[model samples]
Target: MATRARGRGSGRHDGQPGHGRHTTATARPARTRNPLVTAPGTLATPADRALRGKAARTRVPRSAHASWLPSVDRPDPVAVLERQGRDRLPELLPIRYGRMAASPFAFLRGAAAVMAADLAAAPHTGLTVQLCGDAHLLNFGLYASPERALLFDLNDFDETYPGPFEWDVKRLAVSVAVAARENGHPEAKAGRAAQEAVTAYRTAIRRLARLGELDVWYTRIDAEQLLPLARSTRHRRRAESSLGRARRRTSLQAYGKLTEVVDGRRRIIEDPPLIEPAGTSDMAFLRKIFSDYRSTLSEERRLLLDRYRFVDAARKVVGVGSVGLRCFIVLLAGRDADDPLFLQIKEARQSVLEEHLPSGPYVHHGHRVVAGQRLLQAASDIFLGWMTGPQGRAFYWRQLRDMKGSADVAGMSPADLVSYARLCGTALARAHARSGDRIAIAGYLGNADTFDRAVTAFALSYADQTVTDHATLGAAVAAGLISAAPGV
Candidate 1:
């Protein structure tokens, strides 16, 4: 079970340095329950919730979030990454390092653990939410909902957990700053872009707070609704093209690109070190786990799944932080060979945020991820599920591609980045509003830009720290302390 936020003046009991320290406030009756699991009719009134939020500010001031000095005992970023890779595939560690070393933004993408540690060191608003723990800029994207509507929302939940709402906001803001700087924008523009994200979040939360429960829960950002936000003809055209491309990114597309006929059967094409034929034992393991995975789906989804027969499976590498983990792609054919379905089975480890926050209400990491995705996403894939594989390893299953697309942050202009950042911010707030105390959070934010400015300042400072960390990783690779396979 997760621990509840302590009342003011309770002091820290988690044993982490600089955690849960409130400067000026009185203790209230401690609500020792997971905030996400409250019973219906048990929640406080809107006014009371708002007052609770305002009280949090007296403990952790809005201005306090601006500071970003690294402690003398701060863990070496490279060492922190190395520790995460200790249980992963040894041959793939170089790829993860090489990818992260490409740029500071890239480093930030793969260094969730490093950032989680940093965020934990600071005092935060106890306004808790089911965080999109890796809420960086690229992680927000367009995906087809079950109704086949294109919706823009957070697409990653590998590190999702119940934590201070500001943690996700801070990470998103920092990503915007880093991305703006990487695109050659001036520091002032970068800071403004970061602030745009926080501003959108603040306003969105405040609006959501005024809404009824069902209204907040049903809120979504439709992709079609985003077209009007494109200020330039070129950007609108680009947005339309991206959305069109995402619509075409289905199982049929993967079949055309990733498989070919062998004898009378379709087989996955081998691309060694990235995509390879699963060995005999691996194939047997997956086949056994297939039943286990199928049991996790709903009855209707199971019925839908039963119509398909497995065609091929391949061990595939994916993502920066996820590169070294065990991941596989399974191809299934329905009705005819032309009717294909591709499902990805990715390994799920304990989240990086788990170490910093109280225990999450999940023993299986895969279940944690799947539950988080279901709770946070406005609309989720029908095929999302989880199971325990061999050796008690947890794995989550989902469609390899269901009209999924992400913005190209590197190519974005300054204004384009700010608009996109705000869009991401809006999407994130909708997700948080569904699971957190929005009234309290809104009360904390008030109607001012104080939190926005402070977080923007923190984002700029953190971007600087990220650049230094990227250089450190580059140095390690150059000194042969760590191997890197660039351009992989």
Candidate 2:
């Protein structure tokens, strides 16, 4: 590993000196549970048609972008995927793991281009905004601001780009539909979740139209805070338990594996093929770079005058969809072992926004990642910065996990799903509204149902198509075309 000319102690309980909301005006701010939604039973017949049509030509409505290259009508589903797997998958791997959990919808996540291509095939209402392209079910989560105050917001930026705002909503709603299917909910009920989500988004945007811009920026929607809104005792309790757990998370909670420490000579225990330690020399260079990391931060942010130094670093695989990617967590120490700060630097691959988007090089795609993350997130990592790695790769750096948390879809019931989906929709709207113009989009949506119905139709259609693709993936696995864990 190369070095960054900056330094900070690792294993600190809270965060780096000034991450998240503590920073001045900059960047902002997956999974479903269940397995029984059948394409024939859950999706409208048209969705199956969508699943089947991968080669059809499509177009974006004139009002949306005034651009000519991208179209909305979809191609045959089978063929669309053939092109994606051949052309896109090779590049996106080392993708965030954990995202491709044990479901078809989960698998779709690791394949962002596949999702983008599928989304491109859907109908649009011409409403656009900067979108967090990979807004899957599990993506929204809670994280501490530099103040250590926790807030719920978008947590991933690998696919951030400007596009039809509806693309994010459609992707989000369809995820609800698929997750509902997985849960064996009736298709009608699943459709309701999708409907509720869009309605919430529409309503949230309109609500923002009434608030001052700064208010929008300062507003933090938190999950624990929603417990009061919970109508049922069950939801309230769950929310409380979840919040309690989140509030309790500290650096000590995360650094349990490496117990043997003397002079901060820690050893990270190997978790099999998943998280084995690299060579000793490899770690030394990583430490050397930790000292260099301090220079990477703006001098203003590089305060505290060196109370810490880098001690240990290791390779760690995390997130379902992001499992194979090059992810490293460097543990730092200042004055003592307990005062540690853990910084993770993950490789940022090209966005799916690249191939489908109008051609132009993203001068600083890493900068774009940092900027988009700051824009969309309520708070961000203190050490958040971008760097170029060896062998021509780009990476964005941040704290390993400071009071980081997420809503667990696996544990949610339908009513919980409804409330959570609404929360996500509302948050997504706020993110878009803050990053772009709420009025223009609201004007495009008008006091009408055109945007709602079009995307609802599209979400249902694409979800049906996703199941077919999932089956194809299953077949490919069966035939050894690709590989994943058996019974996955």
Candidate 3:
């Protein structure tokens, strides 16, 4: 029989891992950097290297972390969101707001900065890992590895950085709660699903911590491994369907869908406000950008890329949070008219987590994103690279769509959601264990429900806060404080 893990089972792990306690005035004040802005490289060495995990686990007791409430100093969530929107494409700003206003879940997806501010204000465990920074339920997806094998892992890293590992957990937990609520499930169901996710993460981390370095590095979750975890035939069918869909989303498919024959040459189709061709001067500049981007690739990849002739470039709006950012898809054609390749060049800003955590060693934001993505994903795109673009904007390059597919969380049944949650949680654990001190994190989690319950409680509370925040955003749009165009 499988041994069930045990712990307090009652107290809340509610706020940040160590938030809400007051210090005595008589005692000397604890000296630390501005908690809101963690300096880079501070966690390079463990506080007590000899028994780091044990020391950390002792510092933040499992049972001691109960329900978490927001601190009085929590920054205004709207102000944070607005700060991110600044300098983004003014025309697309309305569309970004519209997408976020669709649901609380959508709002949560766009509010990483809001959560980052709140998290920075919360109590922390002082333990660090390569955080996904935006580990929401939808961010975990299936993609093709270099060997053409399908694998599941954290797919978004625009916000990746080293920070308190629990920050990722907290973000993921709240997303589960918000998604479950969007699906009309009871709060209890959401809580249960969030708990299952945290439990899976804790359990997987512990298991990985016991493995050798190479074994942990080799760990992966693929379609074959995930199929058996499906709770029902319906769930299995959905999983297979999603996998099939991803496999068919190759460059050839994209070429057919996004390009047109113009005077015997292939050119990107125009779809204003979403996808539009670059102007004459803009095209000339993009050619230079592509040249610079090629230098960042490996010698072999650069040679391979040279075989293809650049055909066209277009601006495209992609994803909820990334809608207003400067994103583009460059089209290229090989010697054979039928051969095609697509590359995505996305703007790389300082990570939302960067403001709250210690900065990384890399100075270029694009390098930072690519490095972090390579660190977390089991395998990354062969075309993965980064470069500084026009006006010194940092940007990363990758295949536009290499068999990528996301979960339809809003449409899942309660039981299916729980299963999917576990898959995501397990995937997250694998990614973190790749670069984190899994032993110490596992020690903190133990073989119990203490951390699980605490995270679930916090997730539930934050989901409520997100809903209220979404309403505030909606009201702002209604009152013309911010322009919005829904369903764009």
Candidate 1 lDDT tens digits, 1-488: 01111123322323223552222222321236644334765866778788888988877788667778887778999999999999999999999999999999999999999999888776667788899899999899999999999999999999999888999999999999899998999877888899999999999999999999999989999999989988889888998999999999999999999999999788999998899999999899889999888898999999999999988999999999898999999999999999999999999998988777666689999999999999999999999999998889999999999999999899999999999999999999999999888989999999988889878887888888999999999999999999999889
Off by over 4 Å in 1: 1-17, 20-31, 34-42
lDDT for model 1, please.
Answer: 0.88
Better of 1 and 2 by TM-score: 1
Candidate 3 structure quality by residue, lDDT tens digits, 1-488: 11222222332234224232232221211223422233574442332332555555555555444444555566666667788889788899899999999999899999988888766655566667788999999899989998999999999999998877888998998899889988999767888888888888999998988887899999998867888877779878877888899998988899999999899878999998899888887688778878888888889999999999888899999999888888889988887768888999899998887765554768998998899999999999989888887788899999998998888887888898899899888999999998877876776777778788877877877787898889989999999988889999
Ranking by lDDT: 1, 3, 2
Error of 1 at 376 (Å): 0.4
Candidate 2 residue-wise lDDT, 1-488, digit = tens: 01111112221112212112122322111002111133545732323323222111123331221111222344443344345444223433323222343566776666566667644432333334567889987888888887787788888887788665767887888788788778777766676677678778888887776677799887778655777867888767877777778776655665664434656567555664555575687576565544445665777657742666666666776665555566777666766777776677776766675554433225556666777888888777777777665555666778776777788876666777778788889889989987655654554555555455545554565567677767766666567555455321
TM-scores, all models, native as reference: 0.94, 0.77, 0.89
Kindly give the stretch of ten consecutive residues in candidate 2 with the minimal lDDT sum.
Answer: 27-36
Ranking by TM-score: 1, 3, 2
The top-ranked prediction according to lDDT is: 1
Worst 10 residues of 3 by lDDT: 1-10
lDDT of each: 0.88, 0.61, 0.80
The better-scoring model by lDDT among 1 and 2 is 1
